[model samples]
Target chain A: MAVATQDSAVRTGRATRFVLYTVLLVFALFYLLPLFIMLVNSVKPLGEITGGSMIALPQTWTFEPWAKAWSEAQVGVEATGLRPYFWNSIRMVVPAVLISTILGALNGYVLTKWTFRGATVLFGLMLFSCFIPFQIVLIPMARVLGEIGLAGTTTGLVLVHVVYGIGFSTLYFRNYYAAFPTELVRAAQIDGAGFFQIFWRIMLPSSGPIIVVCVIWQFTNIWNDFLFGASFASGSAAPMTVALNNLVQSSTGVKEYNVHFAGAIMAALPTLLVYIVAGRYFVRGLMAGSVKG
Target chain B: MGFLDINNATKSYGSVQVLHEVDIEVEEGEFLVLVGPSGCGKSTLLNMIAGLEEISSGEIAIKGQVMNGVHPSKRNIAMVFQSYALYPNMTVGKNITFGLEMHGVEKSTRDAALGDVAKLLQIEQLLDRKPGQLSGGQRQRVAMGRALVRDPDVFLFDEPLSNLDAKLRVDMRTEIKKLHQKLGTTIVYVTHDQIEALTLSTRIAVMNGGYVQQLGTPKEIYDTPSNLFVASFMGSPSMNLIPVTVRVEGNAVYADTTTGDGSPAALAFAAPSEVLKSYDGKTITLGIRPEAITDPEGADRNSTHIQSVETMVEVTEPAGSDTFVTCTLGGQECIARMRADADVQPGQKMPFTINMEKAVPFDPETENRIA
Candidate 1:
């Protein structure tokens, strides 16, 4: 009956379609409202943003705020011409994502293919990591970092993110590899291809979409992470998120909302760009190795 | 000793044994089939032989060398799995030569071997295509090429054609037989299809309930199935088993039973075995193949004695090549494979000529052949 109703609605309901499109358009506009406001204000002269409506477009459309945000912003964890902190974020994210994804793929491979006695219990323990509040680990993680003498370094931050990222990355890959054909693995074994050879040559090549999903998930999480960055890696090694916070909250004589807007957009731009480039792949990869023909 | 010998091999998962002591000596260049219904441990036995499954006890030897703890690849064997199990990411050439690459054979030699196997399997045109790009038959050919290129002592095929459509399955079956003929390689194949077992194997191990029920050539297995299970399992439409009592009358021995209508009918045995004579007053299963019980004109002419029993035809099914006439005999429904043009209909009296020379008697209690 539901199908029949949908069939008839699909054939005849122009008014229904119009209402749906109108609602969707309204939501799309509603979500874009803040970004629209920020984009408009970021190019306006500082005097103009401070004077009146934040909604109105800039009269002069100067790129001074963007330039200041990119290279001359006074966040100052580094004097590397603007602390662009963009590079800082990338430094933290790239390794964290790569290491976590590779480790996750290996964990997934072992859990699914070379399962041992306590594998389920071990996987369950790792799954527990995904759910544990980040707050629960902060003090212990800080203590461990300090004990290991990696307290405020970029390597320390990467380690923290890698540890935090494994649970989710493993979950994605474990589920994907669980559906991958064991027969192929067996065939590879009979072909005299050892453990790592099969994984590299066969499993890894076919693991395209899941790898994309895993990388995207880890990239977004590690890049935008303010909590870990603030708690663990402060000082010059602070990631873009922590630096962006410093820039916005520093109160350096004048309240430069334009610089703040410009900085926030720059901080959020990499993840947004990633989404734009690989968002479709993220969805496709999530479903890869999941269904068998 | 044969080229490959499974000496009392058994397999178990924890406490539950899946395959019992299975012994079969596969001669070099021989084709051995393990055929049975699902959960009958045929595939498990095949896996045990392939070293994919550990033998609970006993041993498998190839070239008279014990392979008890040998790894599958180390055992010098290759298997074509039911799914064809082609590495989807690799091109056909890469898939076929993967084994050689793993064995550390240099590219020059590996490419030459790949070319030879590709030509042999007629998959030369498919060398550049991924497994996903090819049709099911093409994947099957590539899978076979992968196995063949290895030049292993044994080629194990685990229901390799079970994934194909019926027509393609038949074509591949023929191609496989032809390949075996050409290569003369020892192969141990597992399948649940009886026809495939009949057509492909030089020897067959009919297994059931964790035991090798009977091991024989196709003719021996089909014509003289050692037990009731073998009789019922090996043939399409299966062998008709009728409960009959033996009666000794001077120089002749007869199997006497009632029809579906409770009317008595007696079928005499031609050249009754001495063991069959011992069941004079006891009941036994009369095992007769469908082809052996047919219309008078369709009966085997070479047989010396053909007993005709008039019975009520319960149904007549024309299956293009043959008309299967189902009739009531010995208080059970028996099917006879007659010529397509045979005059037969439902609920009519028909004479189903039973070739008594081809019939075997099984002791009712043990289910083993008495004659």
Candidate 2:
């Protein structure tokens, strides 16, 4: 009788899950509609973009907007020989992601297992900064960067992004580390492992999921940041986000929505490429050790 | 001089002391088990000996050498943790050979050591598997193998079997005992399970509230616990402690209590004058093992002057070779072991005899045994 009840309960659960999937599929389409519309508009001619509906495909597809955006928008390269701000974004974002992820793991390690006076206070400060609005710090950060002679360079932007990125990265790392059994650390200590030895050899190797989270989070944040890029980068050093803003609203003529849509697609490609390449690791990372379930 | 000596070892976090001046000397190649309840500081003392925690005020010496400043690895000690703590990224072979690799053992010798240890643990077939692929018991064996590969001077086990299922725990218990017998290495194990302590230890230390209540051979601790805590903590179907008064009747001291039959049951002891002078008329706790209180005619019989009480059996449990009968006496419930086929039923009045010779007296207020 209990088994029969359990079987029916399972059937009901499956029905519930099927309904949930239907709802989620509808929500996914809702969330993805803008991106789909932009992709379709990017391939359309100028007349098609203005004359047809937003979701309609172009009768005659053209690559003219892509080519124009690549050159005129200075996405591929610029006149100053610095290469367009687009490639510069990659150079800055990659290093920022790597440094932030490594340092995030280190921060998590120190905060969780290692004990020191005022450690909790330091952690509280990190969490406190996450609640502060970025607009409030803009003026002060600009003055500080100007004093340090980093006001209009890639270094200033990377530095600022790392500082803002540490707040969330540390949170991801600390929570994950907390779930790990302390007995493992105690056993490692008993086996004669020092602080860094245990972190590098034991803890870090099992931390694939958290590392992916940190990388994806920091990468997207630094890559798509318009405020920091526009404020801190000047001339050819500015990133694609700042350049896209210029192309969309520059006072040269009426806005060219086709080129703007094409530029937006190019701007979003790096992050999309990363998600596609590392998607497996992303899921595996989040659900590490959950196979026991 | 002992192989390991913990002298006046006490530990405290800040204000509350966890271990109060515990002293014990472990002999060479002796398997010693420290057993107690959760907050008993058995693990704390074990951690202190492993150099994982600082000794609050006392000295811990291994083989007559002070170990306070020595690192855990430098102390020539190996530990098997409950969680196994195997390097998750390393294969079973590398996990077992990690200590050797750390000490820079040559690749060929490391491989040989790994092979020998893996074979000893019967994990030769699991050499290439990561920790995630192994079951709980297998991971534990790998942990033990990692500890054993180094062949350290002393082995420290901190509840290594607590994570296994009941059957696996029993199996691993036997395996650990057999391993200890084969290696004949000095081992200091800690657990809250009394049966494990009784079965595995050359000596058992019963701890409570940061104090070593008693330390003796298993038989000695079981037969003659130094206090009420040791007596109750070290036994299953724990020893029945009845609060009774010792009264002097002429030259003999008799423990007097109301029997289940509503008649006074009295146990007379030819009082050793020196031990009985203070308790001439005061109430004392009479400690008796369930086996000691048995059927009238049994393997060991109490002398006629000892005592006999007739009580209605409240419950009877037949456990294959023996029967456990619980009866009430003097408002306290007492359990007794009798022959499996005893002609007794629930609610039947039967005279259960008490062997006063094996009974010990405890000071009612202090709970310590009256020596």
CAPRI-style quality class for the chain A–B interface of candidate 1: high
| TM-score leader | 1
Off by over 4 Å in 1: A1-9, A77-84
lDDT of 2 by residue, B1-371 (tens): 78999999889989989899999999999999999999899999998898888898999999999998677877888898877888878898988877777676899999998888988989999999999999999999999998998888889999999999999999999999999999899999999999999999999999888888899999999988999999888787888888777788667777777776666777776344557656877888888888878878763743544467777898999999989999977668999988998877999987888877667788878999898
What's the C-alpha lDDT at position A281 in model 1? 98
Top-DockQ structure, candidate number: 1
Error (Å) of candidate 1 at residue A117 is: 1.4
TM-score of each: 0.97, 0.91
Flag regions of model 2 displaced more than 4 Å. A1-33, A47-55, A72-83, A253-255, A277-293, B249-251, B270-273, B301-307
**lDDT (0 to 1) per candidate:** 0.90, 0.84
> In order, what DockQ does each candidate have?
0.85, 0.57
What is the TM-score (0 to 1) of chain A in model 2? 0.83
The CA lDDT at A159 in model 2 is: 86
